[model samples]
Target: MLSLRRILTVSATLGILLFLSFFLEQRLQAVAFRVVMLSGIAVVMAVSLNLINGFTGQFSIGHAGFQAVGAYAAAALTVYGHNRIFGNLPRSGQLPDTLQGFLLGAPAMICALLAGGLFAAVVGYVVGLPSLRLKGDYLAIVTLGFGEIIRVAVENTEAVGGPRGFTGNIREGIYIPNLTSFFWVYLMVVVVVVVSRNLRFSVQGLQYLSVREDEIAAQAMGVNTTRVKVNAFVLGAFFAGVAGALYAHFEQSVSPTSFGFVRSFDFVTMVVLGGLGSITGSVLAAVVLTALPEILRSSLGAEFNQYRLVAYALLLILLMLVRPQGIFGRGELRLDRLFGRKGGGGPAGRDNVEDQPAATELR
Candidate 1:
């Protein structure tokens, strides 16, 4: 049974997210809206990757591969099923912002997203099989290879437009409706964060941490390291797939080039920069990194924008040199901790006690 405090916390979180979604959709400029959506997507990706790389101490880097699979899978479903399921209904972008419109569109959108996530999870399981025998750089290499293989495979698959892209042809009665919104994106954000936080404090999470600390030792202690690592990959890929589905629907298109190794590297950077095994750090890093480039473009104008990458690289180097464990290290930022008050008794207090050793070592 859930406690009253937990219920209230959940209610408050949903209420705040609901208000922000409506407010930001109505008030933000187009550029800001795009940035916000992209930031939410980044948060999802980073947090999922943190489970595998940060908590499980796995160095798999083929996240973009899973995302690509999800994008194409979800896009295919939405485009092909549009006429059959929706029956000449207006695209989500064209729908009026009324409760009726939401009711009409939500079912199809939810189905597509779930299909994408499930397909990606299956692929993740296949990819994770190699992890049973490989570790560290070897596993990273295998995952990197898988990412490239996926890209090449997609590039050759003419059904998804091959190297061109997957933009549905309206004349052919195939169209990817714009079904993504601030509400959907941030709702997933809240769910992923809450899930990650709960997992981080649970008994299973202890198995993950032990694997990260020492796989052999963890195995000796009766933990099924292989299963834990594979579970991490599957869960991480599921969330990445959902994020990709959101991206596909929001952009109403996807290309093979978009989900390449470079994209995977960017997610890796976000995880490492935020601090391994830190959910709050991942969220903060995702938002900052997603917004930073746009901030540069707007502030520096077109001419100086060419040097933005240089500035970005320098900043990362400086941060790593100064605080290699990342901005928040492995601990979360708590209001009580900030106020210099002892954490009140509960699961939250227990989590603080449990996580301290890891954080201290990093410091």
Candidate 2:
């Protein structure tokens, strides 16, 4: 558990880091910038999904559906709003780099992102209501079906460019311009991680864990397992939606295919590959998986690129065989556990002396 002061310090430090990211983005190369932004989005998705699939032990495969909803919502709002507001003005990304641009561009984009999150949260509640009651493969089926349904619905909707997908170039403020994305992306990553961590330590979070450990036991103990499950889904989906918005804004376009069933599995892979119930592991896995393909293609050339996904699948298979609990297992990396290897026992913990009566008596 972190103390209030320590937590606040961490929050402030992250805020400072966000400020520094904007300051440093101007210096980072294009590829590096792209990686950072994409990694941030990955972190958002992986950590948020981990809350549902990892901590809550729910099998949700429709996360991409919520993301699509958010993506299209934000994109439509931005593309249309920008057109209606400024018509032919220069895009927000092209605005002055001075304080004025920061004030205007940052706030408008933040509102759009938050708006996207709000829309997703409402939809998450609706989807979670009926679906969270089920468990195991049934739940997965429901989520998968939900995702496909969203895709089909979007494809048929002529308002958002139909099957061709919604493509737009912003000529003014309404979306997050690519230029300021690193700041927004990493900031949200920090937010997701912090919220997940905090929730896991809260009373409600314990109920979530209890439900994961045993739903019947949790229910018997008076914990509302259904409530916990729905909360997990809604919270996780909100972050996923925010990730979608950031992604859509960065790419400056989105399609039904962008957030398909396969994309949902990519997130699941990140969570399962990372240690479930381990926030740090999720973040690390997100960064590695997000960057692995690019690294391979650049370093190993074109032929290897085609087999990259195969390599990823193989690596996951090997990890399951070798370390089924993932790189870190159920526990997390804590500062207290870093300095020394302490024996598992009482008060300050005792030395490991299973066969030494005298050693046990001494401590």
> Considering every candidate listed, which one attains the maximal TM-score?
1
**lDDT of prediction 2:** 0.77
Runs with alpha carbons beyond 4 Å of true place in candidate 1: 1-15, 91-93, 298-313, 344-348, 354-363
lDDT of 1 by residue, 153-234 (tens): 9899888889998887555756677778787888889888988999887788877888888777777777778888999899
RMSD of each: 3.6, 6.4
Clashes by residue pair, model 1: none
Q: List, residue by residue over 1-363, the lDDT tens digit for candidate 2.
A: 999999999889767876776676678887777787888898999998999998878998878898888888877766676656434324543555554655556655675688678888898899899999999999999999989999999999987767987765423334335424566787888789889877776667777777787788777777778888999998998898898888887887789998897788878878888888778789988899888765666678999757766777898899999999888666566655687765455654222211111111110
TM of each candidate vs. truth:
0.90, 0.84
Worst 10 residues of 2 by lDDT: 354-363
lDDT of model 1 at residue 139? 93
Q: What TM-score does structure 2 among the candidates reach?
A: 0.84
